[model samples]
Target: MSDQHQASASVSAARALPQLGAWVPGYVLRIAYAVTAAIAALLQFPLGSWLYLALLVALVGALRPRTLAPWFFLAMTGLSMLWAPPNTHSAAFFALLALGHLTHVFAARMLAVPARARLQLRSLARPLLHFAVIQATTQLLAVLVAVLLPGSSGASAVPLIGVIAALALLALAFVLITPLLRHERRDERR
Candidate 1:
């Protein structure tokens, strides 16, 4: 083959590879986010209609993280729990907790960074720590509540517990985000 033709072919191949690679990470993250959201929703609702709704919400949220779609998915998941039968299974509860947390984390990260951007393990350390703290606190609260209200059917307390948990999470988020907001303001002033 002529040298010019060979060089052009090699250049095209190189460009093609990176284009393919760039597409993979974004698609993978989106798919993962959608699946996690769907599972979390189904875990709470577990009905066919709910599954379709969840998937639609998840897809929209995954594709447009900056929109209110993610929040809608979260609200849907939370509301579904209201109608769920009294869940005594600690394992299922914990799984749902983790999955929900994951869904939120993935959505938040996708909002902050482009889907095609590669992430390092170290970048996720802070999120992992936050998850650990929240999970521990929640599990402890669950245990305390279970012990304190052994006679209760547990349905009545679910909303109250959910409210408390949501408040705690919101407080934590505020604490974590304050410094970032300050930094951004400082940058703007400069």
Candidate 2:
């Protein structure tokens, strides 16, 4: 191919791929679902008919494409929270969140890429690491506050306190991630 033809083809190939931030909405929505689930677990909500609703929404989320998937996934996750056991266990809640995080990270590429492309394990690793780090960091902070501030409230305050701390940490993460997101966008434009 001629030089001009080669340059044009390369540009088209680059345009076909999405930037990193393209997956941000899906990732954030999934994290929101996980946080909501944790809050529900801490509250120890009784399992009810909502379990079925969760299943149906999750099915819809899995079947749909692009932005709809995250919304449906969020709905499913929110519904699932209402079905938490009456005595929610921390280990179970964390495990559930871990599973959900992996699901979301894997879905990112599928959601962003319409055309068939080589999906590498390395490409998926970054998002998984980023999400786990965010959740683990907030969880530690929440535990610290929960342990130290016993006088804040009785046992009933666990959910409220943890949610507040986690939300604050999430807000901070968004702020910090902004520059990284912009950098990704700039690279995509080049």
Candidate 3:
């Protein structure tokens, strides 16, 4: 065939292939969640048998972010915290925080939008800002806590403080996100 004819034929063949734009984002997010979960699990229990269970949970959660699987995965990770050895390194802790938050955010996004829907980067600005704010606040609090109580003797209060911090973060999230959600609902009704 002539070059132009061959080029057109190849273009037509490419067009015949299934469009995978939708599948790409969904699967990429799912895989990212699973990988983050696995890493978080490894961070918590480096050499334990529970790693397998965590991996399974992560896979399930990644597959069904709209269901309770994500919650189950979070709960499993939380439980691991109770028995895991103390980690004094702030960097590792921050990494864990980021991983958990990103996993949750990914799951929430999957739940909120259809996999086939196109998302604009501008739509992510607000959420990204919120995430930054949360991370910054948490990191500041962590530094303060570390500075105020610099020994293992004060470690007992760490868990309590963590729970309180989590509750506060949840409240902050609700306050920050509820208005947007309500607006979306109203738009849908309209």
Candidate 4:
């Protein structure tokens, strides 16, 4: 090859190295999820209960996708928090939240592309966007429902708590779903 051609080839090869070096987003996400869960578990505060549960569930879903079905448990937790009345010592609600988190993360991971690839950024963006939208919509809807629906007492607080729950679900879902969706679209384009 001529000198110019050799230099051009070398430049192209150099550009490709970073692409190869890029870490898979899913693996980073998995580590992040675990770290977040561990932090929450150790914190043991008002928010810690919910955060820790979500992280644990996400870890499970990452490890096993088909173990759960339709991610309905996630939806149920979100909807129930929005609509259900409050009671003391509700371990079931927390359990549902955990399950929902697991499925959400698993979905994101499944959709997203492996990290280190040039396209990973684009792939990661969609899931995060979708989750943001879902959480915002759910919170708005919950608030609206709480306001419009008849309540016996302390009506204002119910939807507020629901919105919080919805936010957590949204966060969990985005982390899981974003990765998966990116990969799916990339596959289609291929």
Which candidate leads the pack in lDDT?
1
Candidate 1, pairs of clashing residues: none
True-structure lDDT of candidate 4: 0.52
- In the range 149-177, model 3's lDDT, one tens digit per residue, is 76753355668787887799899999999
Clashes of 2: 0
Candidate 3, run of 10 with poorest lDDT: 17-26
Tens digits of per-residue lDDT for model 4 on 12-101? 988774444333545565455444444333322235456456555546644543445224335534554556554312434333334345
- Candidate rank order under lDDT: 1, 3, 2, 4
Provide backbone clash counts, one per model: 0, 0, 0, 19
**What's the residue-level lDDT of 157 in candidate 1?**
80
Candidate 2 matches the true fold with a TM-score of 0.50
- Overall lDDT per candidate, in order of appearance: 0.76, 0.54, 0.73, 0.52
What's model 2's overall lDDT? 0.54
Native-structure RMSD, model 1: 6.2
The sequence of per-residue lDDT tens digits that candidate 2 reaches over residues 1-190 is: 8999999999999889654442333344434444443443333333555544454445444445455654565545544543332122355445555555555654565566443344444565788689879779755654555466546422355556546756998999999999999999999999
- Flag regions of model 3 displaced more than 4 Å: 1-24, 152-154, 166-190
| lDDT digits (tens) for residues 1-190 of candidate 1 | 9999999999998877332222235445567778899788767776688778887888899888889998899888767776674564456766777788788888877776677776554566798799889888877776666666655545568667777877998999999999999999999999
Each model's Cα RMSD: 6.2, 9.4, 7.1, 10.1
Q: Candidate 4 at 78: error in angstroms?
A: 5.9
TM-score for all models, in order of appearance: 0.69, 0.50, 0.68, 0.42
**Candidate order (TM-score):** 1, 3, 2, 4
